[model samples]
Every structure is written in structure tokens, then in C-alpha cells.
Target: MAKRLSLLLLRVSLGGLLLVWGVNKVVNIDHSMAIAENFYFGLLAAETWLPVAGVVQMAVGLLIIAGFARRWVYPIQLLLNGVSLAAVIASVIDPWGWFLEGTNALFYPSLIIFAGSLVVMAFADQDQLALDARKAPAPVSWKARRDCGQ
Candidate 1:
């Protein structure tokens, strides 16, 4: 029960973070473009694709929050977060700018977000609070399987 609750909290928090960022990308194009230019090599025609990426990210975030289609959503979330993390790896490694010029203290949270996404994906089956959990078939015990002589 504790495990389930913890996973639920992590899932919701991560989803919420993604949703907010996605919305920001759509609503504040200039800021999103700045971030892309600074962190993502201008994102290759970002003016055209940023908002589209934002919409897709928003959908993935919603699915993650609802714990729906976790098998697909979890991996998508992982990939998205992984890319973001990779972009900020310098800040994560030297957030104080001790040796890196572009490092920022604020970007360190990307590490935590990435870790949380990994945890959610690793424990997807244990998240009983997820919407899909209720629909999942119960696991058969070893005794039952043996009795059936499979």
C-alpha cells in the first residue's frame, strides 16, 4: 500500500510537471524558443514544431497522470525525460558552473525528474492507483497454476 501511494505521488507530480512545461511551450512561444535555442540547438525549425511537440507532450502527460495505457505512456515519458535530461547534463554535473560556463543551479531538478520517470516506469505494475490497474487481470498464484498442471 505504501509503495502504491508513493508511486502514485511520483506519477502525478511528474505528469503535472510535464503538463505545465507543455502548456508553457504552447502559450509562451518566445520563452520556449529561447530555451530551445539555449539548450536544444534551436530545435530545428522550432517555430513550426514547438507547439506541435507541446500538444503531443500534453497528451502524454495526461495519459501518465491518469495511469492509462502505462505500457506505452511510461516508455514515452521515459524517452521524453531522457532527452531533456541529456540536454541539461552539463548543469546536472556542474550546476554551480564550477567548470562549465552554461551550467545553472535551476537545471539540477532535471536529474530528479529523470529519476522519478525511471522509477515510475520500473514500477508500473505495482502502481495499483493507476486507472489501468483496476482493469488488469489478477495474477494467478503458483499453487493454482500447479494445481491446473500447466
Candidate 2:
């Protein structure tokens, strides 16, 4: 029960973070473009693609929150968050700007989010609260497999 609840909380929080960022990209495209320019080496800055990307991200976020299709959605979320973490690694390493010039304490949370996504991916099979859990086959004990002869 505790594990399920913990996974549910992590999933909802990470999904909510993605959803909010997606909405920001769609509603405040200029801001999104500026972030891309500043952190992502100007990638994802095309005005035409911003809203479309936002919609796609929103879908992925919703699927994550619902714990549906985790096999695919978890990887997508992990990759996206991984990229985000990479973009802000400097900030995470030097949030106070002790040595890094452009570091900001605000971006440090990306590290935590990335770690949470990793946790979700690693323990996905144990997430009984996931919508697809019912569809997954029960795990076979090692003893049972041994008894079955290879």
C-alpha cells in the first residue's frame, strides 16, 4: 500500500510538472522560445512547432498521470526530463553561481524531478496503482521457474 501510494504521488507530481510546462509553452510561446534559446541551444524555438510540441507533451503528461501505457510513457517522460536536467546541470551543480556565471537556484529542482522520473522507471513493475498493472502478467517465482525445468 505504501509503495503504491508513493508511486502514485510521484507520478502525479511529475505529470503535473510536465502538464504545467506544456501549458506554458502553448500559452506563452515567447517564454518557451526564450528558454529554448537560453538553455537548449536555440532548439525547439520554431514558432510553428511550439504549440504542437506543447500538445504532444500535454498528452504524454496526461498519460503519465493516469498511469496508462507506462511502458512507453515512462520512457518518453524520462527522456524529456533527462534532456531538461542536462540543460540545467550547471545550475544544479552551482546553483548559487559560486563559479558558474549563469547558474540559478531555481533550476536546481530539475535534478530532483529527473531523479523522481528515474525512480518511477526503475520501480514501474511494482506500481500496483498503475492502470496497466491489471493487464500485466503475474511474476513467476524463481523456484517455480526452476521446477518447470528451464
- RMSD vs true structure, all candidates: 2.2, 2.9
The lDDT, on a scale of 0 to 1, for candidate 1 is 0.89
- lDDT of model 2, residue 130: 78
- Could you tell me the lDDT of residue 143 within candidate 1? 96
Tens-digit lDDT track of model 1 for 19-104: 99889889988899998888788884377788998888899999999999999988888888898999999999999999999789
The regions of model 1 sitting more than 4 angstroms off are 134-150
Candidate 2 off by > 4 Å: 135-150
Backbone clash count, each prediction separately: 0, 0
Which window of ten consecutive residues has the lowest lDDT sum in model 1? 39-48
Each candidate: what lDDT? 0.89, 0.92
